[model samples]
Target: MSERRSISSGSVFEERIGYARAVVDGDRVHVSGTTGYDYATMSIADDVVAQCAQAIRNVEAALAEAGCTLADVVRVRYLLPDRADFEPCWPTLRAAFGEVRPAATMLVCGLAEPAMRFEIEVDARRR
Candidate 1:
């Protein structure tokens, strides 16, 4: 059997928070919960729709590094701070995953950061 490998993007959380940004085990990639905070500025956007887009962008970045793409995604988990934010952002989410049609779940919950409105995590398999 091939050895499993862990991958990270030098996110400080990998050290301080006891979790990797992404883990690659053979042909599978498991991405951790990612928020809309721009890594460059370390700031979360104020708008929920924009935040949803940014979160998906972050997921794509991790998937790319794992040799996968949105089309390769098999599952998605969305954590929303408020249920009210879901409808407004559904269109964006639907458009992004329309082709992939990955299994998904969205839940209402508080996030790790106060300013963050949404957190997205994904699982992808290489073709």
Candidate 2:
């Protein structure tokens, strides 16, 4: 049987909210919806594009901890509060995922905080 383990990004939310940043079970990794906040400083950008880039980096960190990378991602979810903000983030998003080309979904909804403009979550299988 494959062991299951949780990964953390050293974010207070993971501890305060009681959830891991990602979980690795068997050959699969499930990463939680991660926001744009820089875990080191808990800082977020005002521009959605910048936020999108940071969010992707945060997701990358979690995936790396699980012995995976964006190339291993089979699914991805993008969450945004404003639909318009998503377009401006396309360039940054494309730069990160253009090659990986994982199945993706984008949803317009309220996030945990008003300052959070973008969040991302992913599922990956080790190759």
Model 2 misplaced stretches (Cα beyond 4 Å): none
Error at 42, model 2, angstroms? 0.9
lDDT of 2 by residue, 1-127 (tens): 8979999999999999999999999999999999999999999989898899899999999999899988999999999999999999999988888998999999999999999999999999987
* lDDT values, one for every candidate: 0.86, 0.93
| Model 1 lDDT, full chain set | 0.86
Across residues 32-80, which tens digit of lDDT does each residue of candidate 1 receive? 9988877767677899999999888888888888888899999999998
What's the lDDT for candidate 2? 0.93
What's the TM for model 2? Answer: 0.97
TM-score of each: 0.92, 0.97
Least lDDT summed over 10 consecutive residues: which range in candidate 2?
47-56
